[model samples]
Target: MEREFRICSECGKIMFEGYVIEGGWRYYCSDTCLEKNYTRDEFNEMYGDGDTETYYTEW
Candidate 1:
């Protein structure tokens, strides 16, 4: 049982869920934070329910 910690690219909050977008490597703690950087349509085309696990963040 291993839970990874991640940081929200939008609010800089710590997240227990280790999910992130591929290629660009963008990460968000919630949909609100994700939507800030991507349009609804764009996000839909991205890695849904993804995994880029860790306590890492891309600025």
Candidate 2:
């Protein structure tokens, strides 16, 4: 038998079987989301203070 998965909620991209992790699947398109999750507070350090705002607006 085979299994199926849902698209990432934040990006509307399809997620494949192996991509899912133990607790649950990721919420966004790729490692982009994972990085953002771990380093949101440091966004200013990487891209400046208003960069996070720009990301949401562009999305």
Candidate 3:
């Protein structure tokens, strides 16, 4: 199997595992990174107004 590495959208850290990918397919290693990469307003604009749980859970 090939390894998958993702760079954190905020910190540019190389991630071998845990990921918090955004709707636009941006990769983040943690909630901190995700938050830093986007604001609440930006998230809503990109994903629409709704509970964020669904956003993280569905993927």
Candidate 4:
């Protein structure tokens, strides 16, 4: 992993030690940010390939 500072996909915040990553594609700093962007079901319906394991990104 590069371990670089990633910008939140939803709030545009800097994620330092903690961040939510979806399928190594998009990043979220928190659950609030994730939900604000897309609900789990909604996200799955669109971007997900039916595997929800990658959804547990909150640290």
Top-lDDT candidate index:
4
Number of backbone collisions per candidate: 0, 0, 0, 0
Which of 2 and 4 is the better model by lDDT? Answer: 4
lDDT of 1: 0.62
Encode model 3's per-residue lDDT on 1-59: one tens digit a residue. 76767676678887764434454367766667767767756655655554332144312
TM-score of 3: 0.46
User: Model 1, 1-59: lDDT tens per residue?
Assistant: 65567677789898876337664365678778877887777766664444423222433
lDDT of 4 by residue, 1-59 (tens): 65667678877888764334455577877778878877777766654664653454333
Pairs clashing in candidate 2? Answer: none
Candidate 4 least-lDDT 10 residues: 50-59
Q: Which stretches of candidate 2 lie over 4 Å from their true place?
A: 1-3, 17-22, 40-59
Which stretch of 10 consecutive residues in model 2 shows the poorest summed lDDT? Answer: 50-59
Give model 2's TM-score versus the native structure.
Answer: 0.35
For candidate 3, the 10 contiguous residues with the lowest summed lDDT are: 50-59
TM-score of each candidate structure, all chains considered together? 0.63, 0.35, 0.46, 0.49
